[model samples]
Target: MTYEDLPTVPRAEELVDKAFSRAARAGRAKSGAEAQRSMLQTAGNILSDNLQNVTTSWPDFDRVDPFYRELADAVVPAHGDCPGGVDGLRTHLSEVMWAGRQAGHIRDEYQSKLRGVDADLARKHRKQAFARLADVTREVSEDLEALGEARDTLKTLPDIRADQPTIVVAGYPNVGKSTFVNRVTNARNEVASYPFTTKQVRVGHVERDHVRYQLIDTPGLLDRPEAERNGIERQAVSALRHLADCILVFVDASAECGYPVEVQLALRDELADRFADIPVLTVCTKADRSRDLDADAYVSVTEEEGVEELLDAAVEAVDYEIELPFEG
Candidate 1:
C-alpha cells in the first residue's frame, strides 16, 4: 500500500499536549498527583484509538494477502463484543513493518547486482559495438527490401547455401523454435508433442537473398537448473556458453513458468547474465492465443504472423556477430 494507508497512532502527542497546557495555564502539578492522573488518562486514550492508527498507518497489505488475514485475526479477540474494536493488531503491524522494511532492503540490494557490467561496458567500447550492430541492421534491412522486390520481380525464392547448413535455433523449448526451423529450413527434425521433448540438438539451414543461416534447433532451457540431467539442455548451454553466436529465446507468454510476468523477466535476466554481449533475439511463438504475460522482448511467430518481420529481426539479431570477428 501507499504511505497514506500506513497507521499513525498519536501516543506522544496526546500525552505531551495536555501536560503542556496545564503547565502553561495552571502551573506544574506540585504534588505530581495531577501529572500521574493526566498520564493515565492519556495512556487510556492512546490504547483506545491505537488500533485505528496502527491499521491506517500500515502500508497496503493487499500484495501480502495473508498478512491482512493475520491482522484481522489478531483484532477479533480484543474487539469481540465491542463496536469497531481493536486488539493485537498494533503488535502485528509492528512485526509486519519490520518484515516489510527488511524485504525492501533485500530486494534493492539484489537488484543492484543484476544490472551487470552494462554501465562500465557501456562507457568503454560496448556502446560502439551495439552502435555498429545497429548500423549493420539498418543496412541489412535495406538489402532485404531490395532482395524482396527482386524476388517478386523474378518470381523465384531464395535458397540457403551452407557448407553444413547448421542452424542453431536457440530459445526456451516449447516455443516452436524447432517447428519454425523445420518449416522454413525444411529440416527432417523431431517436433515435440510436449515441452522440452526435443532433448537433443537439431541443425538445418535456409537461404534467403543469397544469405544462408544454418538454423540449429536446440533443447529448452530451465534457467534455474544447471545439472538438470537433460543432455540436450547441457548441449544447449554449452552452445550458449561457448559455441553459438546468434541466439533466439522463445517465450510462451500463455504458459507462464510462474504466476508472474516477473518470472519471465527473471528468465531474461538469467539469459543476459549467462550470455553477456551475445546477439540474442526473442521469439513469441505462442501468439496463436493471448496469455496474460507481457514481455518487452520478442518477435512474434504465431499463425498469420509476419514471418518476414521475424526473419528481419533475426537478421538484426545476428548482425552483432556478423560485424565481429566471431564466427557462428
Candidate 2:
C-alpha cells in the first residue's frame, strides 16, 4: 500500500543513454558480423527491459488499498502541464508498457533480418534497429514524464495502517489538533501554535483495555468551502474521509487561536456532512483558558487534562467491539 519505496523512474534521455551504452559494451564482446548483430539485439533488449522495470515497479492502481486509490484518484493534473486526471495517468502508464513490449518485437524482427547479411550490411541493420526502437522510446517520453510527476505527488502521501481502528483529528488551523494528538498518543510529532503546521496526516498508536487504536493528526481544514481547496489539501481530506473509523473534531472554545468559534463550528458541520458514515466527536480544546464552552468532549492539552477521557470517548465511537478479560 506504500509507494515511497518504489524505484526511481528514469528520465527519457537517461533511459535511452543507458540502453545504448550497455549495448555498445555487449556488442564489443563479439567479433566481426556477429558483433553488430549482438550489439543490435542487446541494445533493443536493454531498452525493453529497463522500461519494463519502470512499469513493473509502479503499484497497480486497481490492486492498492482503497485509501491509496482515493488519494491517487484525487491527484489533478498540473495546470497546463498534463492534460487529464488520475485515469489519464492510468492510460499513460499503460502506453509506456505497450511501447516497451513493442521494442522487443522490433528487436526480434531485426534479428531475423540479420541472417545471411555481410558485416557491413549487418552494421547498417543494427543502426536501423536502434533507430526503430529509439522511435518507440520517443513515443513514450511524455507519458514517462507524467509518471515522474506522479511519483513526486505520491511522495507526500502519509503512511497509515489499514487494519487498525483509526481516529482522525480535525479542525481549523491552530485549534490544538496537533497538541491533542501529542498528548493522547505515544506520537511525539511536531506541535506548534502556528496555523497549518501539519500539512499532511500523521499517524500514532495507543493501547487501551488491551486493544490498540490509531490516532491520525490531520492537516488543519480551513473554514472555506471545498471549491477553494487546492489539490494537495484535497488529498489530505481524502485520506481522512476514506480512512477514519471515527473523527475527533476539535473546537477552540477560548477563541485564542485567532479563528472564532463560529468558524470552527462551520468546519465541524462540514466534516459531519462529508463523513456521514462515522460519528464526529466534537471536543473543546484549551480548557485552561476557557470560559463557557459547548462540545461533546473537552480537553486542555497544555495542562495535561482530559486526555485519556478523550481517548476513551474515541474508543467508544469505533464501530467494532472488543471483549476484555472477566473481572472474576
Q: Which prediction has the highest lDDT against the true structure?
A: 2
Ten contiguous residues with the weakest lDDT in model 2? 76-85
The residue pairs that clash in candidate 2, if any, are none
**What are the per-residue Cα lDDT tens digits for candidate 1 across 137-243?**
23223222332232232221112222322334665556677777776766666776577766555566666656667676767766667755354466566545544
Relative to the true structure, how large is the alpha-carbon lDDT of every model? 0.46, 0.81
What RMSD does each model have against the real structure?
Answer: 28.9, 3.3
lDDT of 1 at 122: 24
- Provide the lDDT at 325 for model 2: 89
Q: Give the range where candidate 1 is weakest over 10 consecutive residues by summed lDDT.
A: 153-162
Write down the lDDT that model 1 would get. 0.46
Error of 1 at 229 (Å): 4.5
